[model samples]
Target: MAKIENGRKSVDTRSIRTISSSHIDDESSLGSDSEINGFTSDRQTDKYGFIGGAQQYSEESAQDVPTEVLRQREVKWLDMLSHWDKWMVKRHNKVRLRCQKGIPPALRGRAWLYLSGGKVKREQNQGKFQELDSQAGDPKWLDVIEKDLHRQFPFHEMFVSRGGHGQQDLFRVLKAYTLYRPEEGYCQAQAPIAAVLLMHMPAEDAFWGLVQICEKYLPGYYSPGLEAIQLDGEILFALLRRVSPIAYRHLEKHKIDPILYMTEWFMCAFSRTLPWASVLRVWDMFLCDGVKIIFRVGLVLLKSMLGTREKLKACQGLYETMELLRAIDARYMQEGFLVREILELPVTAREVEREHHSQVKRWKKIRGELNFKSPPRMHGARFIMLAEPPRRQDLQQNPTIVVEASQPTPQLKKSKEEKSKKKKSVKKKQPIEEIPNPYPLLSDPPPPPKEPPAPPPVSSEMPQIPQQTLIDSPQQEHPPPTDLSLAKESPLQQSTQSLSSTEQDTYL
Candidate 1:
């Protein structure tokens, strides 16, 4: 056992250096001798390859969800991705429900790409990331980002080695963003966000994913003064009043500011606060549902920790409350329970918006005017609107099929000139059937279906149109196709077929 010196256990510097040197890979890019000292020991890691602290994954958590169930969810998610636009336009509620259930881990990266609109952004801004990456970023932001590199997920194997590929990729992504949005420069909060994105995607893909998070999902969040976070902090406090009056009173009585505790939680999206599995689960919902999910999660944590008098009794003073919020109970942090609590919380987007308006009014009253000019915060995945799929007309036009009437009887026939005149006259008299447009302009509601004109009184004198033509016409309603072969194929096969060629190219 190591000896205790003064009130702390003393670590042997020589032994640590020897162990670290022995474990160091020759290929590792760690340059400085001091940096090499920061490497972690080859301690056993959890299933997710995270070292030390409480293990987020265990045999029990794994058994909590069965393999077959996970398989079913993955299949459902693939089908959803195949029809992403349709789901976003018409069935967003179903999408939200599936997200709440927990996205399949294997497909989380792709789902995040889709939900956050990162894939669309990447496609739209092709070569933009590479352009930013090629330039040397501003030295100020680069220096700060470099220092914070290893601080992100240091316990995880991917970032364990100093100057390793993970840190290198993290550097590229964050530096690229500083170049991409020079005004915002860089925020420490963004480092962890980019790090999390890089874990699941390529550097370019992660950059765009970070872009969506910074610009669309949580706008103004990482700006220099963090004004948006402050606004959200007030919004969270206002919301807490409704969510848990007891918790609200406790915080108010102790003069505990929401920003003090929530800045890290909201800024990092709880990556540091929660267990690894729980973090992924929260992210899955956050991307789909947007910042409201984050608000609800914060409310849940506050209520769970301090809602009751008995719970608050121990948290009597400011330090106690802050400590409790900082080091949340393990039981309260469980993935399943936390998710349930979040879902059960009654906070809504409208309430948050209303509270935001109120807070802005109060801020103006107190401080006269706002200082920063931040863009409006988007509530959720409104980016779907910008990336909507093209209409049927925008794609290849349907080939026009001409249907010929049966040949007229010889007696009915006339001279060649007369026959042509009669044919022209007959065509002018016939009513043209209107095909209803399936893809209607989003701004306007689809016109009600028109009833098929009563079949012209069938007469021996009239040429008969083929019944098959009417049955197969675009106007006719047909049940959606169900392919037995597609059903027999595995989820992976279905996903490949469902994704368009272009989508498959950029999905990674």
Candidate 2:
């Protein structure tokens, strides 16, 4: 065995050395020479088709645990995996408790597949990833994804070098997704998420897990529009008022907006914000639970960051407040205490759902009232129009437009040259199929911008803030991203045409 740098060490490369005269007997404990040499890599994987990374077992953190204890935990988890369905059905609470405690590293890959319904999704969508992988992705998104690949966990062992296995797998998974779901295209946030998944499982499995995340756990989240994020930002604001008034008031007073901090937390699932260990623990629970874990984790971060009125009052501006939140001490987010606090939070999933619906309705009404010349933009997704969730049959039949940006008002006065160019372009127009207007509200153009309303009064005593009046300006209503959202498509649904901002300090 030899020592490695950065507190990471390597396993003994000489473990596989053998002699020709060596003989095996029934009395011997070793099953075979290959088994003694760790099953020659092939059999190293368990029954679940997951090849446990050798690096995971040699980490300094693993060294801290007693060997016997680690082995026993792995054995227990292996037994659970053996009877996964029975255990889940008969002891759902126990399963959740185990997940909250954290899945054993040896078993995390298979456990994630099972917990996120990745296994089932993979089975149902057999060969979908391969098919998607074969196709070239939308070049517009491929360039963006390529730039972000090296940026995602650059220091981690898997992604440390350029064109490494981790980066390659991440590229394949993200590229496959862009082809699979042309509507959503590529979002920068999806890079870190896919990178994390690749560390736990193969690229194919990672792709399915990402899909489950997009469709099941957090619908409308990663798409160009980021509609879910905008709605959820309001939900967070409303929830914050109830959970920690002092913190909320401090933010309002300082003009610190939810979009400033919440986008990274929601988009990356806190992968970049929290320490690696804490991020893994959050992922363990997040896969088991759903997006609510994100909300719970976010509340804990806020409380820890601004736990006291004094701390909240001490903050002076958006930059200072965002920095305070981003630099939360790692000790505060330790899995043990953070999970317990999250469990004790006053908010519930049901409450979150209620708030989401209320906020959405409020957003629709605001759009109708303001009729702003420009539609609201959050991340990539545009606020084209509001519509009820279409029925499943309708979605399958019509492939409804889930997101679309309102066309900017055309310039009325054009130069003679521009007119001539427009006429020539019309003459060469290709036959583009027009998608029928999906919603009545979007059919009519917005009215002229109305007079801006008076700013809402801020009060800790008030539980529900008027959604439209929460921010001083529409720009504040949807905070700008540190990175630009993908802007290659005209509108995104199941499939559609292509159609073509932000200030940020301390975005993770």
Candidate 3:
């Protein structure tokens, strides 16, 4: 191969070969072979592009980002910062020099495509997507997504109606996304984010936007092979500590895991909690800001709930705890105040992002050094029904049915052999010793059952309501599940109870 001084590709045609088979030198056979070769010339031949040429074109196109447009962008950015001081303005200007300015909401789709530096990512992703699309429209998709369809945005109106377009698109995007990423497959919160996108944009554009989120924003949140979300959760909580010290301290005090509240936030891009108006507004920043706002918004929500969290400590019951989250609305009364406060926080979006990245680096450093061992007893799906043995009969006479205390797993065969050996060893010895490696570690105790307080010793003095009014009293306190409580009462009923954040974090 000879080098080209001008950096042009030097194609060596000597390596190119044409097929000419058949030992026949007969005139008719030669003519037929020639005819076949002539037909081959009409078919398309693969052409290769020069890497050097591509680079040259890229540089030239990058350089041609019109000077006038760039100047206007600078002006627009400067105009938005008119309220800021000189120092902040200069810092903003410096950052904008490298990063592109955020696109207006009207042009979000095109802008997101360009900003993500994925001009051809769509075409490539779509090709992979088309291969998966052939397997779509399965009945299982509706059943699977339906189970989680309401679960994702329990508080939202758009996904309230399962057969609604809002939810229908949400399901399609999730199903398509799952089909595309079979390794990660379907996760819990993606449908909510898709619903959020469908609220403002068409389904296809929203689908592409979801593709960008899965690829760029929330990198490994859904992958079974990757535990990045669990790892990043630590970093997010740390940011919460800095941003909302009181809430962080409360979580520390109570053992409330951030995963209880913020898991949905990180997984769904705040679609689970934030109001639609605020969610759409935050999404504008989220696309440009990546997942930084998720952390910030978490801090903001925690701060907003400061008053409510304190009130929560006074509440003595499970119903009361759920009532707090179910009734809490971050936008107007609950989160809106915190959002306003967060916008005024001393940290810049860039600084917060830098801190988030630094924290991630720290997490990676620790993950390498530390052994994150999961508890042995933790398993999925299978739940035990604790039934007590009948005590009426004597131990010898009892129709005793012993429940197999140990659940079978893939590792059960080896465990069974070990158990048999232990039995033999015990039988051979006069003195029996406690077995050390008996089974997977004892399971965590289940939450205590909620038993209605023994009906207060019937007070004959208390007047019972007439049958008609009797029905109305409980109805007033807790409405039919159909009439969703959008105001103050609604969220409380829908909320799930969690351990105090403080305890959860310390243990986590």
Lowest summed lDDT across 10 adjacent residues in model 2 is found at 378-387
Best by TM-score: 1
Better candidate by lDDT, 1 or 3 = 1
Candidate 2 local lDDT, 1-508, one digit each (tens): 4445333333222211121223323212544323332334454542212234322222222214476877877887777766655565577667777777777787787778767766666766668888898887787887787778657765455554334456667888988888888877888889988888888888998998887677666777776667678778888888888888878878788877688889989989888776555677788878766677888888888877886877866677788888888777666766566767877887766788788769878988875432221222211000000111222232121222567767554563346568999888986774444443222222244345456555545455433333332222223233322111212212352132111001111110
CA lDDT, candidate 3, residue 507: 46
Whole-model lDDT for model 3 versus the true structure? 0.46
498 Cα displacement, candidate 1 (Å): 43
Q: All candidates: CA RMSD in angstroms?
A: 18.9, 31.3, 34.6
Identify the superior model by TM-score, candidate 1 or candidate 3: 1
Stretches of candidate 1 off by over 4 Å are 1-42, 52-63, 382-508
> What's the distance in Å from true for residue 502, model 1?
51
Q: lDDT at 306 for candidate 1?
A: 97
Candidate 2: regions farther than 4 A off: 1-66, 368-508
Tell me the deviation in Å of residue 295 in model 2: 0.5
Rank by lDDT (best first): 1, 2, 3
Instruction: For each candidate, give its TM-score against the true structure.
Output: 0.69, 0.60, 0.45
Q: Estimate the TM-score for candidate 3.
A: 0.45
Backbone atom clashes (below 3 Å) for every candidate? 0, 7, 16
| TM-score head-to-head 1 vs 2, winner | 1
